[model samples]
Target: VCVFAVKVGFQGKEFAESFEVGLALAVGMTPQLLPAITSVVLAAGAKVMSRHQVIVKQLLAIENLGSMTVLCSDKTGTLTEGIIQLHDTLGIEGSPSERVQELAFYNAFFQTGFANPIDRAIRDSREFPTSDIEKLDEIPYDFIRKRLSVRIRRNGDSLLITKGALAHVLECCSTVETADGSLADLGPYREAIDSRFIELSNAGLRVLGLAIRNVDTPHLHKEDETGMTLVGFLVFADPPKADARETIEQLRDLGVGLKVITGDNRAVAESISKRVGIMSPVIVTGTDLRQLSDEALFQRAREADIFAEVEPNQKEQIILALKKGGQIVGYLGDGINDASALHAADVGISVSSAVDVAREAAQVVLLKQDLGILVQGVREGRKTLANTLKYVFFAIAANFGYMFSLAVASVFMPFEPLLAHQILLVNLLADFPAMSLATDSVDPEQIHRPRRWDVGYVVRFMMSFGFASSIFDFMTFGAIYYIFGGDKPELFQTGWFVESTLAGLMILMVIRTQRPFLLSKPGALFLFAVLSITLITIWIPYSPFSEKLGFVTPPPMLMVIALGVTFLYGVGMEIVKALFYRYLAHR
Candidate 1:
């Protein structure tokens, strides 16, 4: 109103004429409740997502979560229980032996960085007399080396003990120690050892190689890592959680793709991935990734599901490559190694038990490691998006129709179709029903796939429904001016106001879903609000407030004709909706 007054003063237009024209123009514009409606809807969705054990740290991430096309998740803790137990120890000949277990126990017992589950498994298995064993030095684990080494003294002789990924350890060994305590050249048995590793990994055993070397010096250097005797293989088993396969299937059904990224061997990762039903069969290793350029990596990243033996930096690179392939990537991890990848992803997701670095980098966190909870969050996000778009489409359509009616009517009549104050009253009364749209139920079919805002789709939907609504408004104008003799301003405003309110409320029922209105019932609050607002709007002009609001009661015959026009408008919109969705499906 203030802006219009300023325009009138600046343009030197007459106050009476400008004020009346401004009111007519304002009434034709879209409703002013969009920001408030969006806030209410998003807050309600946040509350629903909270109940599913998913915490949304960034509220805007909720929308991105819905649009996520690829989920790159770590397998150990996120997909499994992360509880590893020492299952067996194998000699260099692939035979189970007690001597290998004893060597593994000492290697795990003496040294420490942070506590590891694999170390805990071995330490808790049996008590070793460490009083006779003295620690000399240690090399902590590194992702590139994939191993940790410790030098210790037993019986006044210094020996260096190393354990890590089986293949990595094999490259460092020159000889093998058999169960009989004899050393043989590791060259002849290298092929057999690799075959044995594959067999064990395929069986889902997390396999590691242990090696030791007798050194005269008290210290061990990185150069000393070579010329070591490969002692044996330590086998650990971490079972997948019971619900993992079901979770994978559920996500697949929702049009979300899953990929596994881990530092484990390709055989082990592949065996586990197949069991959990991951789709892409190609595996890319960190070494294989390094040899490829960024363009090559991007092409492979699209078809590869298992990224094995990936370093933290490689993990970040893989995420970037996937994004380049045009996917909205979501990374889930709990270890400090995952922080870089988490930050690189479009939406970083973590669990409640994740390390501080990982948690801080994540935008969304699952309070539990349950994939079911994440699925629920996705559904809720799509629901919020679907309903928000519904309101926009309905508003644009109904407003366009009301505006078109006023533009056409003004050319034939000298008076304003509606007063400025009456237009505001009608807008206020109509919006009371829209507040309930946020909490309304969304159809399962609408949420079966990922949903995102498409400007082209919105424009098409608005024009198709908006123009159909205009046809009905023109029909109502004909009834008021020709049939009921309501050519005067007071009678025309009252008649058109009642008809416009009914049309907006009735059109909401059609646009809120793709299905017919009878099959998709709205929530009780929405239904009650729409019904109550409709009744009150129809009864307003007959009330004592009618004269003060510049309205007059229409005749009984005119009321009957308004109902007929509204009914036909609804039927016409239903037909347009069917054709519009059909057009959308083909597109």
Candidate 2:
């Protein structure tokens, strides 16, 4: 508006033409198609992700997933097969015991809660005649207690069995059920048992401490879980998936950092990470986290590779800290404890079988939970981001380039450089081909790592390409006046418009990729779209509506000369683009 008023003030005789030209330039600079093209490109990427077995629940996640620098996940379902198998059942003496196996089986069978993977593993690993046992009472498992207790009767004797995380279950044990069924003070064996637990954990075995005691009463409650005999360990192993190592390698190669956030202890987390080929892991245990302030943790969050032994509620804190440290964090979560973290992360990924709460909070849901599937989604995500950036680059450079050319031409030319409608037509036509950008193949090198929108990067591209475009505009202005006879303003305007439209639309191909324009082949849809715009640009000036649009058909050889200039412009832009990307590569 101000530009239009100022132009009219200076050029009172050509007031109407100045007003129209000013309006056209302002409209051209506005990113009229930004939202429209971004939505179409992102929606297209989501379909590609669906083919990779990834479902995007939130549309914005498509771009966020592409920009994710760190992914935090529990090692179980994603990095490893969720299927668990009972590795061993051992006594307090660190030897296999039938008594401990029987106790674990009975507890697994009698508890009223859902049969979890560990319970199913226990039931499958041993044969137990279920007909002889009678369930009297049970205490269901909760993450807070981290243990479940069940009281059962068999052969006229009643007993209570408890099994859960070693640290939590060990707190309830007053004695140890050593080999041969002899009970001894737990204090004598606490250190040895803890050491055994660590050793088993360090070997990547998930250990559950089993405890047993005579229960005269039939009722079982939280208070009744204490004073039991520590029977032995029920160890389970959930090895990494067949392709887990390769998947981790692929993620690293794609510049995505892996961070394990699990309920497992530091040794267990480290052990599993190493098994999956993650090296030199820095571990932050939940115990250590409990003592640290939010500020302290935020500073330390980016330094660690694993957040170990974190409680369910603390998961949100870890994600928040990473986000605060400027990471576009992607969190994989499924448990009820994961809702907060899922909602807090930049992009939350959940499995198909995830809990309802988790799935609802997540932005992406995987039909099959595997790190490899995530890699495919990331590729599609980066493609979406790349295409959008390409459009933005074209819009900024082309529009600003023409604006610069118009400002310089208006100063010396007797007539308006381009009528209002001609400049608007240029802006509209230049944007037509860019709508097909989603069909263009992105440079794999650009998407190798996470990318964020940088204003400075965009500005540099605008200035460089815009300046190159202005140079051609200057050449066209000189040619129209000296060689083509621009005594009439219509002739000069028509000549420059033809040249600017041809060169501006071609900017898409040059800025589409860092590779040389000919080397990086564009997709068929994009090529067709660009050709369509080119044909319209060549036909419009010679068409019947030329008079209404303030255009006079150029002399016989003027278009041929415009075509020659456009060719030179493409060659010049290609060289400028090559040098510009090379400088960026060095930077």
Candidate 3:
């Protein structure tokens, strides 16, 4: 409202000017809202002031987030829905019927102490016949016993229903009947049922044993919950994410190994890993990790793709071990349990809806909570790091030429290679575009490839290429000085003009990683524009302005030579760079 009022008051003013005034008044009148507005305004400031806060608290957080190399995460709510569902049932005994299944489902539905995935599955199974099914005494689920039992009244008769781990249920049952109405001794079937249970468990499926017993009279409660006939086992699981398998394959293509660090049972973790394209035949559990020394642990981590029953502390230990082996680890997590490990990784990335501490501790936050985002983030980070190194490479190279030309001219000639203004202009003009492009380059192929930092390689290339280019500029400047007249003041003017032109070309060469002859591109065009403007200023005539800066018009032949030498120098530098890059590639 205030902005509108101010804009209406200054209707005749230019749009931009009115906007500026209106903005000022609007902010000035609302002092209480200043802090919030100030945050928004300063949020877009340089990294050092905003995201890259220098305070110790923020610095430590950012460092931890950026340094994540391995991620340990919880399975429930992190990878799966934390909700289990029974999608199908296979009956092995006694004429499989929906009536029998509904009875088992009803018993499971009403007996619950916790809102676990298994319980939810029973409740979601569809409405049962409550009129015929009367509640009775119940034995709730126990982690150790791994079973539950209930007594109920149905159709004027009392019955007992029991469900539990298949192996435990089979141990107490003496006989089993098939759905085809055939009976078999429980002794021979025990091994077969146990083997099937192991198979299902290894695939991360939850298994449940079902059984029922009939009584002569209806009863609300009963004892002797044991010695019931075993019906069959039911398997349940939370389905895998649709893209998990494909994402794992993509990570493998980029040379990033996929490891499942989960607090689930070993069988469960192994199952999920196999389903998601992890081919590792072995799994390492927290118990196994606890028994190994640090060296053994690292060796194991290098080989294993699934770590199960991993506690929070063990997550950090695994990450540290991976880092010690010189691997750059990226930790992806979403729970508070992951915070410690997240803090210990090379790149800590969190899903958008992750716990507060996890998100705050992460360097990168994925707006979408998907594994694919982590893949994308890694690619972008690598490109950013590469471009930054390139900037450092070229900046040092250009500086080498500048330093060499100045040093050689001071010793062997009457004048320096460049004046103060010329040096300042070249530094500003050359650096801006180079830095901009360095920060902005996007390479599509980079995401599909893995890269490791090699400090030695960077230093070697920088020194060799930078020194060679500097020497060339030095020799070229010396030749110009000698040809014009070594000690004459007139030659000083020619030297300055020639050296400045050479410096511009040297900068142009540094900017182009490929061919330098192509100056029609936007980057090269901007470079030339700035160079021309600076050179024109040096020649501009004025009693106060030009004279004070030692301006002097040059001979027409000097201008031609300056332009010609610059073109030739650019061509030579490009050839040198190409050869150098080729040699490095082959090596």
Candidate with maximal lDDT:
2
Model 3: CA > 4 A from native: 1-194, 202-235, 280-282, 443-448, 451-453, 488-548, 583-587
lDDT of 2 by residue, 1-587 (tens): 65666567765646776767777777888888999999899899998899999999888899999999999999998777988899999998899878889889999988889557888898888878879888898889988899999888889888888999999998898999778777899999999998999899999989999998788864666988889889999888998888999998888888889889999878878888898888899889988889999899997788988998889878889889999999999999888888999999999999998889889999999998888999999888998998999999888887778788887677567677787788888878877788889778887787898887788888788888888888888888888788866678887777777888888767788888888788888878898988988898888889999989989888867788788898998899898988788785334
Q: What is the lDDT of candidate 1?
A: 0.83
| Cα displacement (Å) at residue 452, model 3 | 5.3
Kindly give the stretch of ten consecutive residues in candidate 2 with the minimal lDDT sum.
5-14
Q: Which ranking of candidates, highest lDDT first?
A: 2, 1, 3
Locate the minimum summed-lDDT window of 10 residues in model 1: 2-11
TM-scores vs. true structure, each candidate: 0.91, 0.93, 0.64
lDDT of 1 by residue, 425-520 (tens): 767776877889989998999889887777888778778887788788877887787775654778888888888888888898888889988799
> Ranking under TM-score, best-scoring first?
2, 1, 3
Top candidate (TM-score):
2
lDDT (10s digit) by residue, model 3, range 500-548? 5455545544444433435323344435554665555445422255445
Which clashing pairs does model 2 show? Answer: none
TM-score, candidate 3, is 0.64
Worst 10 residues of 3 by lDDT: 51-60
